[model samples]
Target: MELESPQRRSTMRDAPWWRPLGPRAPWVAALLMCAVLMSAALFIRSTALESSALVARGMANVIMVAGFEAFRDADGLPDQAALDAFLASHREGGLRYVAVLEEAQPLVSAGAGKVGTRDIQDGSPLRVEGARARLIHRIRRPRPVLGPLTLEETRAMTSVGDVQEPRKPLRMVYEFEPLTALELESRSQRLLGVAVASCVGILALAFAFSRSLAQREALAEELERGRRLAALGTMSAVLAHELRNPLASLKGHAQLLAERVESDTLLAPKAGRVVSEAVRLEQLMNDLLGFVASGELRRVDADPNDVLRAAVETTGSSRVEVRYLPSRTPWPLDAGRLQQALENVLRNAVQASPEGRPVEASVEHQDRSLVFTVKDHGPGIASGEEERIFEPFVTGRLRGVGLGLAITRRIVELHGGSVIARSHAGGGAEFRLIVPARGV
Candidate 1:
């Protein structure tokens, strides 16, 4: 009703939450994200480089230790030099040691027990048998050492009998990187990887949450709509019952008026028109009542073919011969309702059928359901409207009210069946329907 002044408007528009600030506004960012990252990376990288040689040597020691552990954890004793050489390599990157611990003798018996027999024979090409069944193991606590550890520091970690020392040295090896550039590089890459992974995980979570919220909102809307329809149906049912009897009486009175006068030819035609319209009105009222009780159903076992034949006869189409093989398949049916439904189908077939072309009614069994097909040579329904024609009050006829098929479908659905209309591959239209068998 009232426009704001310029000062008030500008103040309102300048609020932070309402502003669009992102990749789009590159020139003047809401704020700059100063990358402490590069500085942090430099510090870590520098520290790592200063320590590289120490780390490489430390890693080599760890490799030796790890190899010694393999011997201790093995099924039998390994060639000592080969074991030491393995540990000296592959265990780099400032790691002091990585080893597997097991009992003194591994081959004669692998399960939990004390050191047993010397099961392994001494040889360059080792020969062995039985599974090297691994088991739960533990590492020995390293004895303390107090000196600048030498590269031979790896020897202390070997299995008791593995090398030049049958009895391994009793000392813990301690080592650290001397602060170097390579360490800094490795730390920077690790930090960057962690940051990127966290950002991606955050975005994925946001999208999933948003989609879930939207689906919940849509479901809530649909449930509310269904509640409203249920209320509307109750009111319509009440109104239809009240209107039917009065409408019938009105038609009867008009008929009486037509019989009472001879000079009322035009008046008689007017009375007939009144009666005709009244009948149409009654039919429309009945259809509304039908819609209100669309869910109510009574199922029984009955022959679909018999029901279809009866409907054809009721249509009074002497020229439209109904052809169907009498099949013994019994379907779960609501007899009166099924008759009404099929009669509607036949009526549409009869209307669509060209005079000498016989409208067809066939029933067959497929899977656990019964299928009823009614086809005619009449021009096919308009392509786009095939689905719409099933709605209540939609008709193909020039003056059709369209309710015929809608009511028919309601009858079919109550019996756990569905109807569909499609163009026949051979040029006409076919209506194929399936209904579940009764007591199956």
Candidate 2:
């Protein structure tokens, strides 16, 4: 069975719900979330401002009405001394001036500034207006009785003004200056800054959470792939073991048949073909078994150049060009297993190169690790199949069972090394094998 490629596996799996927006999802989500928070902050600020304004107006009206009631006598007529005393007590309480208007004429005035009849008549109840410095005022008409004044009583008394005409109902006007626009603006800006800062902090936290979740998801996926590969290795080992005996018996019978067949007869060629096919099958079984098998390594300190030369000689290829950069210190490795792994890679490189084109092999030390590189001049590995080619039974060629690279990888891994394949800059495939200088 073919193992699934990493790309195919990822594509087949369903992505997390939050991943639909792709890599920039965090930034996009953060911006949109912050925008919504800012809108809410603005909305809340507007609502709070409106509420505060309403409360201020209501309180001011209450204060003015109370002052008017305090100045009135039981007969419901304003007393001059009482009005003066009430104004004096609340002079510093944001109350600029207070006046009593009778029939569009000022009757009793207290505090600063002279009051005009038109000013009292034109002023509405609890009105505020300003550009730079805000002015708020409350105009109230005092009731004849004072306590729990009703609208019906106010209208009845005003309607009978010509008959009784007791004193024209008093229009109590109170004016005060509130906060300036610049001060209020500065306060609002501070609130907005705090809201913006809060939003940024929340976005940062959300981004961190998303990053952590992505890392855990990736780790889980890697673990799952490892499990699948382990199970596959187990199954392949069992199958290879079962087929070994029968494959060996078949090869032996084919060899006996070839020996018995006469060389001059037509049966000889057919028997020879049978023996060759049987040999191929045996080799295929051995390759599969070797890939699934685990073994101990006999590590020893050896020169990397000697290993590379040995691998090149094993391939028996005259078309290979070696560029060996000798290391100062010898590398510790399993000589036999390392040579086998190198031979497999070198042979593949030699096979991949055109007849005249030289296969380039190189050895170098980098960052405490020995690096071996083999480059072929033939058609490079197909795009998106670099990692898949190392899987068992996966092949780009038509010939033998595709277990050479797989077995090579197993051997190198046993020695705690890594093998990677890529397309070379000069138009071919390149394989790099990196091994630690000290054996694991």
Candidate 3:
């Protein structure tokens, strides 16, 4: 029935993998949300860029086709002046160069620099070259022909409308400059950077919020625990008061009965049992009263060694071995209250030891505080019951009501002291009580 350490218990609660992440859970969720948003933004950006590229290419084709049609005559021969004007109008629209080819040769060209020589065939449609985009259209027309007997041919041709032969197709090749892939990629990267920065901000804010929330929860839990303790104290006080009068009357009657039946052996034994039980009940009631009362110390300058010796003698246990190391100055404490606390602890240690085993009690001064220790060479306190032993009505012993150590703790705490229980390295239970030299 040993009580667990507060730190150990808290560690156990957070031991599960998922439980350890509770405080950080909000931050994790926020980061995930940011990731989702960033992914969506990038997806939309990529889609828009792709669609824009398609639309730009479509619009370029339309502009080139319209300009080519406007320059051509009814005979399907391009006007040089009209073609020059069309090229000038689109010069600022990334149109680097324009060329009209006839029979795989340049017929007319307009640009800041010479257009490169490239293989062009009739009926070749739109195509892309390095740093340039091109559209090609073929134009066909009738060609005039002369036969032998020029005067007769002229007269026969004059009688008919006109005699014509098929001519070679003319290839209208229009080349324009287009945006580079590197420039588009740079723009997309800038957008991605902005999204990433926004996500980082979101995560940071989430972590801060989570930290504040965890602190609030801890404070609330502490307040709740204090409220419970205060309520328990009130209830114990009422019960102790209600039971004390009846217990005192019972003890008095039992004592009188034991005296009256002194001569009859059987009757005397029965009366003795009743008296002993009453005494035990009275002691239990006293322990309850002490535990519930608000501890108010009557402070005086006293020697810690003297207090230890007095407590050991009060326990009336011959099995206790006393050790004391005196300090230069006496400490301020409520001597009676401290003696009672020590007596309770010393009694527990002595009771826990076997007949032959000695309980060790020691007192010393360290770090301006009186340090009292009691240890028993017996089965140590059960694991996980070290702290619980100090709690009211919690004990490892079968017959113990468990209020002794609880009362001891209250008295020690009232004097601004602390008590801790642990298993000694040599295999026994050890209790250490530390009281500050200055009174509370």
Candidate 4:
């Protein structure tokens, strides 16, 4: 496969808001721009001042080199004779130095009085070809007070060789001024300190701004939630008022038919079933509205055993068994409402239990609280539907409007209690209601 270049890939990844940048990017860019401006200024200054300094240093080196060449050559040094002879033949032109230098060695071959005739020479030139410079002074010999001469000016200067060859090599030296060490250190430290202080300030402001943004987002979210709840409340009130009157009429007609029906006859049996179902539906609607009624609490001390008995009585079944470890326990409850809530849970359990599989009701006192349990043996509810079954208007049965469990939960929560529904160990769902007992 062919590969795309980095530039093309980077362009593809670019998004409008997901800029390859940060909140502080603009501030940092501004700072860098200032540094660039200052750098441009410094560059201009350096170009001007350094150019002048280099010219001045070059001129000084030129003067020093020329004067030193004259003085050094004037002295009677080794190979100086050759330099003088070359000078005599070729007078001063643009030639900056006639470098005739030497060693202090005696030249002899018995027949020729002094075999190597030259004993004097000139020095090499020094110059600053492409740099800043300050070359100064000249020397014929190593001065006792200071040192040997260095001609920086003649570093780029022209030179011509003398006529005679030297018996020994010459020493070469380089020269230039050094930068002041302390001045460089001070400037570097100052720049570093300023950068650090600016970065610290930027980070502190970033933290405060981020925190402020988060708080504003949270407040906006809370306001949105309150608005939604208020709107829902208004709609629910309108819906309940509109539906109740017709529902009452339907219930009345169902009851009239039920009074005239005979249980064994076919037409009457069907009519009786219609009445029973209609009554159940009407009762469910009442529960739905009742669960949402304004008052949430009417706490009172009452026997938990009595509450169980009332729930069983409401079920109107003679077959279901009741069992309790601690039959009587004083529980703080809104007696009438709590009895209705438990009745709803028990009635569902009885319906779900298989024929001849008697539903079991039990009550116990634990940890300063009353625990009531209802168990049934039947085909287990679908796990997926279990939680949804308690949601308003959701049902497992075809005929149900699905408010029983939802109303049960509303009442339990109203009384500062809890309920849990799950499959029982013996084979079916177990619903438990836990409420506080009447005590400190």
TM-score of each: 0.50, 0.63, 0.59, 0.45
Tens-digit per-residue lDDT, 140-219, candidate 3: 54354545667876688677667666566666666766564324645676878888888888888888888887987788
Query: In model 2, which regions exceed 4 Å deviation?
Result: 1-35, 45-191, 326-329
Q: How far is candidate 2 from the true structure (C-alpha RMSD, Å)?
A: 11.3
Over 1-440, each residue of candidate 2 has an lDDT whose tens digit, in order, gives: 99999997797586666666544577777888889879987976776567657655655766666775775453444557766777777655556666666655666766664455555566555555442112224334545455775998878867854487355455666665443322454566677888899888978877897787678778888899778878877887888889889988988988888899857588899989988988887777777677767678788888888888899998998999999874545778887778778888888888888889999999987888888899999899889999999976788779876788988888877777899999988988999998976533
Model 1: ten consecutive residues of lowest lDDT: 125-134
Q: Which tens-of-lDDT digit does each residue in 266-355 have in candidate 4?
A: 678777777777777667656656645665577777887788888898899876798755546566788888888888888888888877
Kindly indicate the candidate among 3 and 4 with the higher TM-score: 3
What is the per-residue lDDT of model 1 for residues 144-233, given as tens digits with 9 covering 90 to 100? 456786667656746476556344312112222323334445676687676556555555555565556556656877687567656766
Arranged by TM-score with the best first, the candidates are: 2, 3, 1, 4
Best-performing candidate as measured by TM-score? 2
Better of 2 and 4 by lDDT: 2
State which candidate has the highest lDDT: 3
